[model samples]
Target chain A: MALNQTLSVQRLDDPAPDSPIIEISHLQKVFAQRKKAPLEAVTDFSLDVRRGEVLGLIGPSGCGKTTILRMVAGLDSPSSGSIVVDGKEVTGPGPERAMVFQDFALLPWQSALENVVFGMAATKLSREERVARARAELARVGLSGFEDHLPKALSGGMKQRVGLARALAVNPTVLLLDEPFGALDAQTKTLLQDDMSATLQEEGCTTLLVTHDMSEAVYLCDRIVVLTNRPARISQAFSIDIPRPRGERFRSTPEFTELVDQVWQELKAHVTLSNSQAVVEG
Target chain B: MSSSIRTAWVAFATFLLLLAGWWGVAAIAPSSYLPTPLAIFERLVYFVVEGGLLDDLVSTMINIAAGFFIAAALGIASGLIMGVSRLGRDTIGFFVDVFQSAPSAALVPIIVVILGFGREAMITIVVIFCYFIIAVSTAAGARSIESGLHDMSATFGASRWLFFRKVLVPGSMPMIIVGLRLAMARAFNGGILAELLISIRGFGGKMMYFGGAFDFASLYALIAVALVLTFASMAVISLVGRQLIRWT
Candidate 1:
């Protein structure tokens, strides 16, 4: 549900800061399976993400938004292009970048607090300090009383919250979230999105989010990049000029509605095209 | 009744019925071929107190312990190595399959020949029989760890030792314990078979000697002792195993 409170659009200077923290140039990804034709997921895609700004990537199914995020996170190697973070190219998954997986990949054997602590295990921080930080991190995620619960005991939303806390606990220079709220019900998704957005901004984290939800992109991202279907290239990138410290009422604002409508309209064509192609092939 | 109580009563009923059937058959059968239940019980007590049965029990228990211990250690170590290393798996996997399929029981005569028909040879046979099963099971457990978890570990920059301790050991524990249970059972078979085949001075050798001498009551007593030993050992191992892996 969107809040109906309407107010005139108050101007804010440059919705996102001008300083860029992540630079992607002509990035391409292709995967091969046995006896199958090589699948080209992305090609010739490029974008710059500003420091302390959330960037959302939206596209049709199989459009390779997650592949781009993984390359940036250093979990997957780029086929032909480079992802430079703070001027250094990413070689592999490193301590400076942490990923919040779509699957909520918390280790099953670990308690929520232990999962967060595990994220910082490789750091040179003292064990006592890591434990304290993990406690604070879990508290920040609204899981203060449930710190001892294992992933099997938690609901999907709670597990995801733990995933977010784990990434945050690492104090990464870059945060990569792949469909962070995709598995949740709409109500839980909205609430978590709001809480997580506020916490992320408060921490001044540089985030790259991949989502299929157009409204979610409008709600959270400072900029949204839409990609074409497979062999994905950036079709458009829009800067969201909505004021910061957005409230529930902001969702009902004409500007927010307009942005959401625009993104949906832009994305609808890609979805329709993919579906029609699939039908034709079948 | 609660399931545990029901299970206990069912087992008790089964034992009572089996004992009654044995007693009935023994009453009709010749004393030389099938001793009466009361006679077997008396002989069992006599053997335990006066006929050197306790010494054989101690000897058999020691051999089984040495064989099982060496099997468990070597099996787990080699299994982990084969699981973690591609070269180790490739070089050793073929031999493991061959050894597992070969039926080590048939090799007793060959083993006695090479090792000179003694306690050492019997121990070697048990180790061989036990380790094959344990190694295969351990390797399967280690190798079956999900690839996603491995990727998670790598992404989190976990060191090799940390990954092994936090991921491999705990993840494979339940499977390893199951393998140990099965290996211990097989160790009993191997140890007893070796003693019987080589005529060693242990429980199996005593059973063979009593059987050849028309001492049916003593033979029946020896079998009952073996049955009790098997159940007792398995129960002990399973109880210890449950304590170790209560998480699963």
Candidate 2:
């Protein structure tokens, strides 16, 4: 399409293909409370996401994994430290990154296609080009026939598909997924994981996925970073070392199981420690 | 279609029941005070056919429409500002709270003293009656938009104009429309009340003329006309609102 032709020639200042596209150094976030001591959420957390690689962040619930993702997406500011994306220091949200929320935050009043188009509002594309790109992205996510449906008319999985399509429609340099499939049922989750893996391979898009599900992290991520309890710090980092386009058969393999188990074992220690701490505090 | 037909039948049955109740009450009450349904119906026919009440009805409608449209414009604009800005909330929203709680009819005499008992005074009374409720409800609607949507808009790097047009306005529409429906009801009450108190004009004037002449049937007829007009306008607002937010 003419729109694709224009987009293909749009990226003139791209960095080296193998270089890190996003660098987060020594990030910290604190939540202030009235008449009480301020709470620390994330501290000394840092990571670099290489171009065209899927990185996963996993931890127990409320471990600030999503907080780190929001920081990278520029939806929230860090209390200290810095994030550089595409050779630019991030001060606020920009067109370089798009987030797929866990809640499938599609605008209830907009159709699936319009929601996708809304994401392209920051781009320099014309109205027709925006509509064309939106349609193409929606079709890419298997929502061609359902473009006119509102988010409420869609099931959980379909809604997330629209969310994914919206993120992808802007041709963002980095895609941020905050438990994108966490709200779906088990069966739908499995189906979407497979589709997501295939789509990531096809697009070769850089991604930072925040999820608590160990198996999901193992299946999709090239590298997994496990975080500790609140005031989250990186506790462990594991490389999947598995080949790309890993299929459903890989989920049954001993290698996948071993990798998932290893991550789970690392996460279980933090969970136990936080649970005991919670008991004491309560 | 079938459900709509059933709704119409139910409405017609209710109307008949209400008329029967009124007729029974009329029999026990003094005839001069509470006219029978048939007597009121005859007076209604007279008004429609030859009583020159049509001109009064048109003038009252004009006052109501002018007052309501002006109030709506100012209310929605100020309401949006109050909703999104802290300063606006503290200032405009503060007065909205005060006026909404106080009965607006209490201000009609003051309004007459200021605007001096005419169409302008009547319209000002209608504005005073309707504005506060619309502003209050619109502000509440604006405040109730989900935080996630705001975050989503920010992440997309939406411009302020785009955010207002696409997110803030549409997100707050359901409540804004609800406020409009309520304000419309108040508009009718205020317009008629102003006409009665400030000037001998409109349907209010006709009612006053009938009441002074002991024509209870004509007074009741005018009251029924007002009731029908209010219900019809409210239904129209509801229908338009439903069409606009079908996605919800």
Q: Which candidate leads the pack in lDDT?
A: 2
Task: Give the poorly placed runs of model 1, Cα more than 4 Å off.
Answer: A1-17, A249-258, A273-282, B1-42, B214-217
Tell me the lDDT of model 1 at A266: 75
lDDT of each: 0.83, 0.88
Show pairs that collide, candidate 1: none
Q: Each prediction's TM-score against the native?
A: 0.88, 0.93
Candidate 1 chain A has its poorest 10 consecutive residues by lDDT at A4-13
Q: What is candidate 2's CAPRI-style docking category based on DockQ?
A: medium
Model 1 CA lDDT for position B11: 99
Which candidate leads the pack in TM-score? Answer: 2
For candidate 1, the lDDT comes to 0.83
lDDT of 1 by residue, B36-113 (tens): 889999998898679688888788878888999999999888887777789879878668977888878888888878
